[model samples]
Target: MSFQAYIDNIKAKTGKTPADFKKLAEKKGFIVKGELNPKTKATEVTNWLKEEFELGHGHAMAIYATFKGKTS
Candidate 1:
């Protein structure tokens, strides 16, 4: 799925928008330097998403892809 599509799916699943997710990630220290770089490492992102958001692997991966700009 495209990045937008993944984000849309996340919204559907969590009832939160991409912007809201971004803010939550920021609060969790997942976002840094004003961007979520593709090279940030999946494990880190996955852990944060799982721990803070209680998202499953699929959903976390979708969030990762969106951050990496790889989904599209």
Candidate 2:
């Protein structure tokens, strides 16, 4: 899916807009760097996405990739 599509999907799943998710991620220490930092493990981010947003793996990873600019 497209990056925007993934973001839209996240919003649909969590009832949170992209901006809301960005804030939540920041609170979790996932800095919004231009790219997915090598130090920022996907598993950690995934856990937060699941616990806080109740997102599935595919959806969580899609959100993560959107934040990391890895999706297109």
Candidate that would win on lDDT: 2
Per-residue alpha-carbon lDDT of candidate 2 for residues 1-72, written as tens digits (9 for 90 to 100):
766777777777678875576677776668645344567898998898888778888888877776776546
| Cand. 2 Cα-lDDT | 0.73
TM-score of each: 0.64, 0.71
Model 2, runs deviating above 4 Å: 1-5, 32-38
Clashes per candidate, residues 3 or more apart or on different chains: 0, 0
Model 1 scores a C-alpha lDDT of 0.72
Clash pairs of candidate 1?
A: none
The Cα local distance difference test for each model comes to: 0.72, 0.73
lDDT of 2 at 14: 71
For candidate 2, report its TM-score. 0.71
Instruction: Kindly report which residue stretches of model 1 are placed more than 4 angstroms away from their true locations once superposed.
Output: 1-6, 37-39
What lDDT score is found at residue 18 in candidate 2?
Answer: 57
Could you give candidate 1's per-residue lDDT for residues 1-72 as a string of tens digits?
665776777788779875676677677566776478545688998887788778888778877766655545
Worst 10 residues of 2 by lDDT: 28-37
Candidate 1: worst-modelled 10 consecutive residues by lDDT = 63-72
